[model samples]
Target: MKAVMVSAFGGPEVLAVVDLPDPHPAAGQVSITTEAIGVGGLDSLIRSGALANHGAAPGRILGSEVAGTVTEVGEGVDTAWAGRRVWALTGESGGYTEQAVVSAETLVPLPADLSAVDAVTLGSSAMVAHFALRHAHFARGESVLVRGAAGGIGVIAVQLAARAGAGAVAVTTSSAERGARLRKLGATHVLDRAGRGAQDAPAGYDVILDIVAGADLPSFFARLEPNGRMVAVGVMAGTPPADFGMEMVAAFRKSMSFATFSADTVPALEQRAATAELFTAASRGELVAVVHEELPLEQAVVAHQKMEAGEVFGRIVLTPSRR
Candidate 1:
């Protein structure tokens, strides 16, 4: 099978297409033939060594999720899964290849109505958005604010917030074009993120989903309404500094709380439950995933570059150049 491997750690230039022996499934696993592989920002982070401290160094393919048809099922697995279309999380072995092995448990059977492209696009993103909002204890009629709302998880956050009956759904994005797209997706207000958050955002948000973390933390903290809650999600901009401090006097008096959500922190069954809900929603056409571009697997370097350049507002799908 051909795979796009991060031959070295540095930049998108390091991603190389290499032919490797096809991977086979072990017990309780299945082999999936590539259809649409999700090209996420975290894959770029691993290729660029930005997450080297967390073991994202080179010499590995860096796909996060895959949507494909099951070609083979290993022992202890149900043969019925074979030939069934599915989408699953691939973890670190990655899914940027013609064939990859995935744990059977991670596979989510795609409804006949859902295309593999759309399933892969929102597979992990919708679940993350759901988990983040749930962690914040989001309530109906609450005002919701989503940072990095043009990106994968953030876009889902915006949609889910609006669909969940948020009194208002505000989003922050890079341009008028992206913001307008977000508005069509359910954002009641779209603010330009290039400006200071405090200056760009409306005050009194009941739920703030912070996908971009940087020097903008304090400003975002200020936008929270009294008793508002903020959930720190993806650190796409950069991780918060150790000394990151907010003006807590107001926060303390208002009973506002800040927290973080990670899929790793949740139980496996709980995570899958969220994923199931997402798949059900997608099948019902209640959740829509945007695919910004599709490229051959060998063009991973181009994909990662586009991600880092902020040229893509949605997920990118990559397929093996060969069968």
Candidate 2:
């Protein structure tokens, strides 16, 4: 099997395509023949030694989101999943190869109407969005704001907020090209992030989903209505510095709270249920994942470069040699 491996960490150039022995599942696991692999920003982070938890080990392949067909079941695994289309979070890594092993527990049946491309893009992004939204404890007909609205998790956050019956939906993006698409995805208002124009955003959004942490935190804190919440998923821009201010204190005094998450913080059952719901929603056309580009497995370097350069508004999928 051919896989993209990061021999060392530094840049996209560190990633190379090499032939490796095909993977076989252990007990309670299954081997999937790659149909599509999701290229995550975190994968780029892992390749660049940015993300703490996903750093490259000497022999590690750099991806965790996979959507493929079950080709073989290991001992103690149910054969019922054989030949079924499935998508999963492969614990840590091993998703970039033509054949990779995943625990049966992580595999979720792909809905009949969902394509491999769509399912792979959802990857961990959809679940993170789900967790953030639920953490906000939002009510129906409440307003919500999403930052980095053109990115993988940002897009999912927009759709999920709309499906949650938000009274008003606002999404912010730096690119002009994504504005129309964001609106189509159910954003009632699209904020132009390029001009530092978030000052024009309507005040009192009940929930703020902050994927781009470069925004004025105090300003976002001020935008929250009394008792509103903000969930910080990613700091794509950069992390904010800790500072003392009355407004920051007052923001908390006004009953606003901020939160973030990791897969380790998500319980297994909750993760399973969220993936199941996402698949169901995709089948119903309520959740739509956008795939902006597809590259062959060997071109993984180019794919990572696109991500690192912030050139892709949606996901980039990888197809193995056999595909």
Best by lDDT: 1
Q: Tens digit of lDDT per residue, candidate 2, span 1-323?
A: 99988888788898988888888889989999989998987787677776655445746887887888999999999899999999977765578888888888888888888888889888688988888888888778999988788888888988998988999888878765687898888888878763245455566789988877764655665778888888788878767556614656755667877777566688877888898899788888888888889999889999988998888887899988685
Error of 2 at 204 (Å): 2.5
Worst 10 residues of 1 by lDDT: 194-203
TM agreement with the true structure for every prediction:
0.94, 0.93
* Clash list (residue pairs), candidate 1: none
In terms of TM-score, which candidate is strongest?
1
Candidate 1 lDDT score at position 189: 81
What are the RMSD figures for all models against the true structure?
2.0, 2.2
Q: For candidate 2, which ten residues in a row score worst on lDDT?
A: 193-202
lDDT of 1 at 29: 89
